[model samples]
Target: MDFVHRKLEPPDLQDCAPQGTKVTDTDPRMIYHGEMIPVGTPDVAQGLKDARRALRTNRFRPTGRRKSMIIDGCAGKTTLLLQIGRAYQGLLETERRPDSEWTPVVYINVPPRRESNLDWSLPFADFFGMDHTINIDKRTYRSTDMTEPVAHAMRESRTSLILIDGIDRIHDSELTTAFDYFDCLQDRLRVSVIYCGRGAIDIVNEGLHNRRRSDRPGASEQFRSSLPVMWIRPIPFQKGQEEGWRTVLQSYDDNLRLYNHQPGALLELDEELHERTRGYMDTLDQLICQTAQQAIEDETEAITKEALDDMRVGRNEPDDDWA
Candidate 1:
């Protein structure tokens, strides 16, 4: 027992033996968060090609315009959405659009922990090049008061895009209610809404559609026409999924070389290290970064199976069962 451990009133992993320390999980990085990714067709390159075509053809409206699209998927929806949003923002800045035409973007995570009712109008202020402050605290907002304001804002903007991630976490009842607001708002606005989630938004839209189909004329058909839903099928992690993975693995080819570099270099367990992480981009990233830190503390030459295994699947040494 050293003074560092003895003197500290509160104990942590510092008290544990070197071997007991854990830096990261080598567990399966096959987790699929709600990311915006190119919906690779059935996880194949050609599938992606076809999906892109569908997005351009079937999803596009006259004048090459399109209503908001919902990219629904259970895995990697947020990552995918951010990627697309990033690309779109870059293009918006780079390419030439009419000075008068404004298609601002809104990226939000509608989690179970988020404000139940959101004010969509307030969020897009910055995107549209407006200097308005709405919903200053993201963590504390409830969306209940947003429908009217959001609908009004959408109608005002010439063209707009809304990218909402993690909406599935919001309850069906709330979502349906929200759909009513968005639908009514969409009726007033020609906005193209994009929703990214773990699964499909059809059920949500269906409920919203059903609500109006009973008494309204062509209401259900109109609702379907208003917002079209699309799914971003899983793209197989080919050579680590994206092309960037190839560069990553190539740089870390010599597993032993990792030890020579900065401490916490993830050991190249296999020549196809990048290949192994394909389709699990987000998960593998987390695993590699975390394991690297642990390797440094352990003074290991390279990331070992023991370390990765500990991260992915627990070693579960021992713990006193509390009553």
Candidate 2:
């Protein structure tokens, strides 16, 4: 017997909205929140796979700590990290130990502009479902006092992965100390670590260079030799990939038609949108949301070229009318 392949259908518009309400009547926030459909670009998929491999390879290292660095611009770094966290969490759930009570993967955002390394303990504690305030007695706790509880929690929980997002946000003065803290975490906890941020390659390289020249004894050498950096290349809108744009639009409104079924309607629309947005996933997301909301407000069944053109103009205008 022969079987024919079939393409997956778009999600129901109602599914993107709240229960018992039409998508058109649903608030924009509600719709936008549910629209986190990653396009699965090759670079993103490969970067995630490489990160997981790095985690597995670093799991058994003792003092030779290795980390996976995901370098990307501000455009889609957070989204990619969130998606990776979700994917890693799902994989961990599948292989969850029967006796383990803690989550296998812990994702924490690096605090922005905070110089103290102890501040990181808050997010780490929260990830393990512990009260960070309990560790803080009179706001005077040693770094070990704060990190020990986190280590104990991970030990009890059997967490295998640690994902630190926004490492680039660490202040210049605190950057070296932040790396040292993470090195200590891996050395003490013996868990896999992945750091995501923009322009981290230069910082890490400079730190390694400085460590090599200094007589200081630490894990800096281990980090320099073992850690593998994975750069997420930009998602370029290549030719013959118009279906990607269609998929994004259809996710918002399944009934959306680009140009009334014209011969090259989708192709034209895809080219224009890609050119305007420069193939940035974040920009694509914003444009889709903005265009979808405008269509709903205008009581139109489908977005038109005119509406897209107007949105593009408003986006470039200094008055901030695009938002």
Which is the leading candidate under lDDT?
Answer: 2
**Shift in Å, residue 52, candidate 2:** 3.0
lDDT of each: 0.44, 0.58
lDDT of 2 by residue, 57-148 (tens): 66656566556554555466665666666666666657764344756677888865355567767678766666555446677644333678
Candidate 2 lands at a TM-score of 0.71
Off by over 4 Å in 2: 1-36, 59-66, 97-100, 134-145, 208-226, 238-267, 312-323
Q: What's the TM-score of every candidate structure?
A: 0.52, 0.71
For each predicted model, how many residue pairs clash, with residues at least 3 apart or on different chains?
34, 0
Q: In angstroms, what RMSD does candidate 2 have relative to the true structure? A: 8.1
